[model samples]
Target: MDTKLLQEIEKGTKSALIKKNIINYYIQSGSSTITELSKVLDLSIPTVTKLIAEMCDDGYIEDKGKLETSGGRHPSLYGLNPESGFFIGVDIKHFRVHIGIMNFKGDLIDEDLIPYSIENSPESLDHLCKIILSFIHKQNIKQDKILNININISGRVNPESGYSYSIFYFEERPLSEIISSKIGYRVTIDNDTRSMTYGEYLAGCVNNEKNIIFVNVSWGLAIGIIIDGKIYSGKSGFSGEFGHIQAFDNEILCHCGKKGCLETEASGAAIYRHLKQAIKDGASSILSKKILEGKHITLQDIIEATNKEDILCIELVERTGLELGKHIAGLINIFNPEMVIIGGTVSLTADYIMQPIKTAIRKYSLNLVNKDSKIVLSNLRDRGGMIGACLLARTRLFEI
Candidate 1:
């Protein structure tokens, strides 16, 4: 399982680039006959054969028995050796972290969730680094085989520079570089919403729809936009701040220090605040006793309450969904995406939120444009972020 061989590929060699293309093809299309590879990679038969043989000997690619055929001889198939490389994806949230492991073939082989806190302090970053290293050590694989790590943190992350401007933003050097140095591995940093969007696009319900939007309704609100089959990062990689668009007239100050932002009404933080105020105003619901006892309620508890048929919780969640959809209708009039995915911690409440979101979109957006967009829930649920991190790490590492 040595893809350190990849690190040695010379920058300018024709054969070196061809070999990378072959591997990339397998990653995207799975196993294929050399004949198919020759045609797809646009190399002569002899060249494809020679390189395929060399890759086999170098342990970069391996022989699968043959492609199934009806009558004639089955063509021999070649594909990447999944053991050659591994990737780790970590999705860090406010009080928990999810770690996932993926092999070279783009399969999520294993995953885990651990309770943790993310904060803007050197000590917090140090803890994040140590926990990642510890998690790696606990897995039953060679450390060198784990070629890269991708960390998905909530905030403004310039993936090109690996700098997070919000969570764990207490450093001059790139956070990816810091974690890489500590863990002794190549690392990439990504935005949590973007990572989750990638997860939903590749592993969720997205299928051939090039234009899509993923709205994350979590502790905060943001979006992941895919345009023409690629994630749209805008001009400065700071796109998808969907919740910050000015939409209200009230003086509800957002944590971003802005007033009348949609997040002040639609995010998990907003829900928590509103729910507490409702209870304080003597509204009785399933959580009334807990609220009276001063027990802290989490987004997860609200989701659970909705599932338990709590009337007040369901109403608040629907209100958030309606607010979110109202803003998304404006997006539809602009981008007219084929699909809009409702995800994040609050999304686990399922249709308790989605119905209102869809209702708002239909009510506000143009009928022609809104009908073109299909609203759905994330199939991967809360798992999208970590899985997306692994994908980002794997594919981006291949670019290098």
Candidate 2:
């Protein structure tokens, strides 16, 4: 082919891909009219109408009745064929792995949870792979119909290269590539905090917010930054290590080999450690019974104790909340985000945790910045990372 002709063909192919992506976006966002899609996709109404008509004829989309309008005629709404394809999202945490399966229309089909410590076993990856395979088999979905697998892990991840800095013992090969080869599927990987941030952007508390911060305060603390309506994975995809920021001069060592890091003071692990130490020091509390009974007191136990207004649990949570809030206040001053969402299992405590955080924000952050930023609890909670993994797969599969 002539060079000019080849260039023309490439351009046409790119345009078609973009149009198809628009269709996928509409599908994921639920039913919408051509006018709405055109506006969202930045395409002309005539072009959107033509593409929608083609998709309808191809059985990829169908008229889903009409949407009520203010004054004009009801607009015809189009939605995707639910049976078109499937997606899987896997969230690999320190102590558990969560899997979620969804269809083309973004409806969650099924989910599974497997509890296993990644740090304790060398064969954790093999076990995880087996569980994933078993879960897929249980879904009764064909392998070919599954578009992609998205995995979110806690660490610095290069989404494009599929390598994680803090996982799989930093092995020679990229984790995503290895998993894809084993599972016989295309795979994408990302940092768990970033994934949860994107999840909130798509379907949680930070929806439609251009500038936002999502803080995950589980076993550890991490923050996800969103700038200009997109996840801001800084150079080397390691931007959101908020937990490692220096908070105190105490000799307490952090897991990252640092002393007095924010995570050492404010994370769920930190809270558990402090509570255990206090119990060892003969401090009286509800959790002391568990410790005396030779049972390890978990973060959940502390949260439940706080619910019952136990003095020790209440005080410890408040202290951790204050520490976390101080760090978040610093983030607010530096990033000037429109919103900050506190997520993870700890956030379930509601006012007990949030009250102290709010107070600390007021005391530490600049009045102008703190007053404008809305700090709220995440609606997605622990599921944000898994949902985000599915969204990541959908975005890549449809090029949306």
Candidate 3:
């Protein structure tokens, strides 16, 4: 949020805090009658009634129709105004960006993708800012109506301090602050994997499953954790760096400059590397001809071949899934979560990716612990990060 806004919120009194509570309540419960809200918020009826009037006058909330009552007078419902504010959620990849806008009610209103390549440099950072502003202009969204811009980026990001350790590193100011200056809007940045996890938790399947783990098997690998029904960002918001854990004894270097990391053997990068090598070793498959020609291979191409029953592709995919599951089984032993969600580009392979992971879990994890957790694929799939960023923007807005 802006500095002035933060100052106001911090200096505000008890009534201000209660107003925040009311906004958060509507966000969580959709809509509620004054009587219901008073009971839930532990406030007097007159107090809630007055606050409701103030919020309505301030254009933050609105009065919906009354709820039907059998005998006594029907109670009117108050809820957030859907158009009171808007949020921009950006999912940034190395070479792609997904931009979307969401209403205050957490509904995605518009989404678009841009082929914007980003590297760890000042120029790339400025390029991202231009793209965001351009998107807003193209959509004709008023700057005043936009509440904040929330970005989901891959790598080591400490969301609390708004500093990104992996990309656009700076010494003086946090990345979010830098971007905010360029775009003239409040900016919030978080780990992409964590945002994807939140997206699935809020909008995907697995209804009300509190303790959860969302495994993102993309070009690289990472995880998002939900503990006690809240997104678990550890000391520096780096709690779910699942891919960097050492799981093998090898010399292959990972993107993080470490050897023997799980990412070196089980990520989308692993599948691509293994598939290409297998094809070079006289393995016959749909991707073999492309491999023989020394053409670039993408994870999507490999997944398509696997879905078409290519033997080499299938083996490579299953190997990745099996390795992922073996490691995930250890997590089950530790966390005993209620659900584990598999997501990202690799998940598009569907059964080719899921079956092997399921097998490894059944064979490796304790039956008792594994039984408490149901492992499944993400319902949001490729859209998780984008949608999650939008939801993140909405939820963080009321944190003041």
Q: What is the TM-score of each candidate against the true structure?
A: 0.94, 0.89, 0.95
Higher-ranked by TM-score: 1 or 2: 1
**On residues 1-400, what C-alpha lDDT tens digit does candidate 2 reach at each position?**
1123123334667555755676557744778888888888888998889877766665557789989879879889888866667889999765678899988778789998888667624377778888788888888876667878998888678887788877665468888888888878778888888888888888787656799999998888899998998778887788799889888888988888889898888988888888888988999898898886779656777888889998998898899899889889899999998999998768878888899999999999999888889999988987988998887777665552
lDDT of each: 0.86, 0.81, 0.87
Report the C-alpha lDDT of model 1 over 200-281, residue by residue, as the tens digit.
8878899889999999989999999999878887765788998888889989998788899889999998888888899999
In order of lDDT, best first, we have 3, 1, 2
For model 3, the superposed segments whose C-alpha errors exceed 4 Å read 1-7, 10-12
Candidate 1 minimal-lDDT segment of 10 residues: 3-12
TM-score of 1: 0.94
Which residue window of length 10 is worst by lDDT in model 3? 1-10
Tens-digit lDDT string for candidate 3 (71-180): 88888888988888898999986458899999877888899889877788888888899889988987766677898889998889998899998888866799899999
What lDDT would candidate 2 get against the real structure?
0.81
* Number of backbone collisions per candidate: 0, 0, 0
